[model samples]
Every structure is written in structure tokens, then in C-alpha cells.
Target: NAGVTQTPKFRVLKTGQSMTLLCAQDMNHEYMYWYRQDPGMGLRLIHYSVGEGTTAKGEVPDGYNVSRLKKQNFLLGLESAAPSQTSVYFCASSYSWPPGDREGTEAFFGQGTRLTVV
Candidate 1:
């Protein structure tokens, strides 16, 4: 329990609804990311933050927003839910980027949040 943790393991959301996914890490990592997993596509980054109070858009940021208000927490928000947004969300944290030559610096992932939009 000293790694990444995501809230609400499963949820069913109606179209046009809104929700926020919470990701918290206790490892004091400098980089945190939010990713979604689809059937055909693998994990796609939604948003990421390099440090506290700083965030950047990732591959699929159209229907998502992110905030890193604290060093240990990263939040992903959906303004309006859609069927296309339904996917398994994963939160991760890493001690370094690229992880080059770093044996123990690989990103740590949560169990994932399964969301269904109908």
C-alpha cells in the first residue's frame, strides 16, 4: 500500500455526466501519469505531471483534464462522459523519466479503475 492508489475501482456513468478520478502516491515520485486502456489500443496517456502544481496534456487529452495540486496526488476529470470515454484507467508514478539505466525506477501502477459509460 505504499505505492499508487486509485479511487472507485468500478463505476457506471451515464452520458453527459461528470466525474473525477483520484490518484494518490506515497512514494514521493516526481512524475505521475493518467492512462486509459481500450480494447484495441493499449495504454494511452491522458495527462501527466512532472511535479506538483504542474501538468501537461498527453496523447488523448480531449475529454480529460488533470491537476497535480500536491506532490502525492494527481487527479483526472471528465467534464462530460461519453461512451468513447469508457475504458480502464490506470494511474502511475515514477522516480525518473526514460528510466534509463535505473533498475528500480520503473513506473508503479495502480489496480485500475473500470468505467462504463452508457
Candidate 2:
């Protein structure tokens, strides 16, 4: 399985520009998520899908959107970029997390998508 692969390992965007970062996994996992990491902050969830055709907003869903049309792919779209969005984006998946405990689940992460907004 490819696990997860994110396109455009690095990118630069001017203020107000837009971009879409692609994430694909071959594990056939049912859950997928998009998160952003900033200095001194832990990964903050932007959006997630429990399964294909289902999407949900997360803790930090503002300024971002997500789509899960295919079972193996999750796309994160930034319509208007801002300097505050200049952070490392990470896409993660899990085959199955340990039941009954959220912390017990191990999430597999992609290399990362770095976006710089001037």
C-alpha cells in the first residue's frame, strides 16, 4: 500500500492566492483527515471524512475545505491564502484505531505539504 502521498511537497503562495493540496492513500482506510501545524502548536484538524462521500469540519476548519469523492483520496482546498495559513499541512489516515480510546489510535501521516504565504 502507498500509505499516503501528498503532492507538491512545498509551495509558495502570495496573499489571496489559492491552491489545492492532494492526498492519496492505498490502504483502503475508511478515515482521512487534513491538519495544519504551526510553530508551538500541535496539529489542528481542518477537516475530516469518516468514509467516502462524508465530510466534517474539525477544530480549525475556517479558511479551508475538504472533499472525499474517492475512497482513497482526500483533497484540501484553500480558496484564499493568508499569511496565517503559512504552515505545514499534514494528511493522515488510520486503518483502525484502538477501540474505546482516542489516544490509543495511531495515525499514519504523509510527508507533509508546506505552504508559504507572503
CA-lDDT, candidates in order: 0.94, 0.90
- The 10 consecutive residues of candidate 2 with the worst lDDT sum are 96-105
**32-53: candidate 1 lDDT, tens digit per residue:** 9999999899999999999999
The parts of candidate 1 lying over 4 Å away from their true place are none
Query: What is the C-alpha lDDT profile of model 2 across 7-86, one tens digit per residue?
Result: 98999999999999999998787889999999899999999989899999999999998999999999999999999999
The model with the greatest TM-score is 1
Residue 116 error, candidate 1, Å = 0.4
The collision pairs in model 2 are none
Q: Of the candidates shown, which would achieve the greatest lDDT relative to the real structure? A: 1
Sequence-dependent TM-score of model 1: 0.96
Give one clash count per candidate, in the order shown. Answer: 0, 0
For all the candidates, what are their Cα RMSDs to the real structure?
A: 1.0, 2.6
Model 1 scores what on Cα lDDT? 0.94
